[model samples]
Target: MTPRARLGRLLNDALHRVMAEDDSVFVLGGDVADPQGGTFKITAGLAKAYPSRVFGTPVGGAAVLGVANGLALTGEKAIVEIPSGGSVAQSFDQILTMSSRLVSMYGRTLPIHLVVRCLVGSGQGDGAAHGRSPQRHFLGVPDLHLFELSPVHDPGEQLAAAIGLGRPSVFFEPRSLYGRYPLTPRAEPGVEVTGPFGGSRWMRLVVGAGAGGPSGVAAEVTVFCTGGTVARSVRAARALAATGVTVQLFVPSRLFPFDLEPVTGFVGPGSLVSVVDDGPGPAGWAGAVAAALATRLWGTLRKAPVLLASAASVVPAARELEDRVVISSTDIVRRLVRELETP
Candidate 1:
């Protein structure tokens, strides 16, 4: 892969490959079928390659999802894109009415597979509308599942694997990670990248020792984080390593139907697990993970692990203000040193 490689484009490539292999698979959305190939150019060239199957749509979320719902009803698979996370609020009724019932009613062979894709998270100066990650709204929604694309994992495999399950699902990629996650081979020889979870790995150990290869320093802190924050958490691990406090970085790929295995298995008597979230407050992903981990590991933990997320407030558009709201590597480093490791 070249230095300019991006997860979005690679995902488009995977979509193209899968579409070519399966005639029933089709994709449509605003800017998605354009020569520009999406806001980040992830879907480039697919329209021309599969002109019959890949096409563009109007900006209306309901209208776009409506078309997807139609395609799914007709024994066809559809991958629909909505621009941002908040944009999804408009399609809630459509999703609730249409997504899963159609799939199960129609049976597995003719499964109505739908992949709802959207861009989420804050980059640098994104405003309130564009910056918000809206998955939290669907936290308890029935049948509709939520997943994230981590920069540390392969985008195509994540996309295909989620779609292969033959159900309706929502998968979002963080805006900030598109440019930051390298597309080329690992610059560091010792590092490896794998998709969210293949098996019992649903609660995956993304970086550090469980990431395969030589196990370096033994893990002292079980660090939990999701997409967009994985990079930051990894850096925190590295920084803590320098100061003699080793941390094991854990990234969970799937959000709904929370996986307890790796985290439960990792923690033992006197062990600590830290959940580092990017977005604000004492809730959302961090809260859900903390609750689940605490329930299963209740008897095993030394103390309740610390959860570091954005401050309980609106995320700011200004770079400095935004930085203050979310967790960072420095936040992870200092928190580990003061809260977990230090006597």
Candidate 2:
């Protein structure tokens, strides 16, 4: 099946699971009840399936989140899907103060399973607000879990895995990738799917052992990337391989609580590293990984790795402009060659 179809099926299964497991698990969003399905069609059939539990909330994001928080505290599970990044901005305060803070403050122990599914990245002319990677905003929040999903060929697996987690997760689906990539047969039902809120996964070295000269010949360069940027990094790796530069591309499936064990092991003394992100430079996961590497693994590195992120600016509305701001495969290939050639 197509990737979008797989994603839709996955989401549908997740919704059904949530409903069957907990009567309190309700869906609240801005015009998510019908037709448009909150822009991305993630919640397309939810309202029809559970009419009483599904609600079309007012445009006020803060109120919607606040209400969800209240319900969660009272032993309810809420899936709040915002229309776009722009709409979610209105709920920041509620997200930070109420939903995030409750777990630590009162030990409320309430599982506020927030599945914030929004379209991010470019190519839809969604404008600055709609086409933003706002996942950076919730990075530092103590009690919340942030996750960004870039399902290249399996939406059903992605959605099932994302929603199966019974905690607050910031699920960011790339707008540009929707309905584009196809789903592989690898995406099947009944597979265990992890929640995005849990933590980031380690980067597995994809390079073949013999291909890297000798078995023990460690990689001198490490490339860290996430989301669509991971695909770009893969392309860059292929290009670098053609030029006789053997580089390792580490793709983190999760964005928060940056997993260091696998990454640190791959990076050693004098290793050249670079991070590629699709969002603004400063607040993206790249910065977080860089800081961690500096503090925890600096002694092992030869030089400070460079961070290749989107230019510090709002996402552009036009397709061409958006493409420029966002990282592409060509951009990755270019950056890798330049960095390796310079020093």
Candidate 3:
């Protein structure tokens, strides 16, 4: 049986493994090595084992990020953890202006091995101040490899994959599912997921026994999603199947350097494609995917691709209120059902 572990533990172990495997690898963050182990306890033990490497910095996210990039440029690998979603916004200058611009400055780089980890997403009832889902913001920055650890995906594997990029990389771990791992296998993930990333541009998966696999019919809708919403998205996809809206999930863990080839082939014009995300609706990640799909599959799609996302307004404080504001599994069902039933 596969061992069950919380995503937090998996990430912690992944970091430790990296640091151990490579002498140059280390961690940098605000109060990361303290007794509390940062906000989520994802860096709990490194401070004790590798005190020389695990750095606990002041509350300034930008300063530490700048320092991290500097170290990476000097042949040292650094894992800088952003304390909050808001903090990433604070450190954008260092992220975009420096870290992301390194390779492009000369059209090449010397392997500035920086693995930045940002914890994002909502639903902790942390209130509006701590309620921003800022994965969309990172997507705007170019030249940085971006990946998110989905709820059903292994944190260690995903983080390790990001670290493998050997360049500047930003990994978003949706806080809502940090400790949300189940003790047993619920079901096989509906898609072939790879990369920090889904390694291949894309691969095909037959969800309904293929066009003749078992159910003997092709999926009616192609669903795309990432991060904490993955498990919920899959559930909604399966639930829709019972109601005759067969669905398939296109989960590219990596966003930037995004390969739209697989998506283009599978989702043609008029094909039901729903891009679901926890990020804001307007000018966000989902919108980016939708726009790209709408263009690639133009003239053939029955209509424009659908974008399902959380409320465009501020994230609510209460869990119940938040659920209403955010896109839930049931919400996917309702949205896709309406679209699928149309015409």
Going through the candidates in the order shown, the clash numbers are 1, 7, 11
Backbone clashes in model 1, listed as residue pairs: 280-310
Tally clashes: model 1.
Answer: 1
**Order of candidate numbers by lDDT, starting with the best:** 3, 1, 2
10 residues in a row with least lDDT, candidate 2 = 189-198
Query: Tens-digit lDDT track for model 3 on 99-181?
Result: 98875676665676787888888878866667777877777676688887765456676677777676788888788777766
- In candidate 1, stretches whose alpha carbon ends up further than 4 angstroms from where it belongs are 1-4, 104-110, 182-185, 188-218, 341-343
Rate residue 167 of model 3 by lDDT: 72
- Model 1: per-residue lDDT, tens digit, 1-343? 3335676666767888888888988887888886778777777888888889887877788888888888877878888877777677888777877775665554554456788887888756786777777666666666566778876566776777667766677887787777664522264332344333434244334344444522334456778788878777777776765665545666656677566664455454676678877667577877888887888878777678778886766668898987787677888888777876454
Query: TM-score for every candidate vs. truth?
Result: 0.87, 0.83, 0.88
Worst 10 residues of 1 by lDDT: 183-192
For each candidate, the alpha-carbon lDDT, in order, equals 0.70, 0.66, 0.73
Off by over 4 Å in 3: 1-3, 106-108, 182-216, 267-270
Clashing pairs in 2: 3-183, 6-156, 7-155, 7-156, 153-183, 269-300, 270-302
Candidate number with greatest TM-score: 3
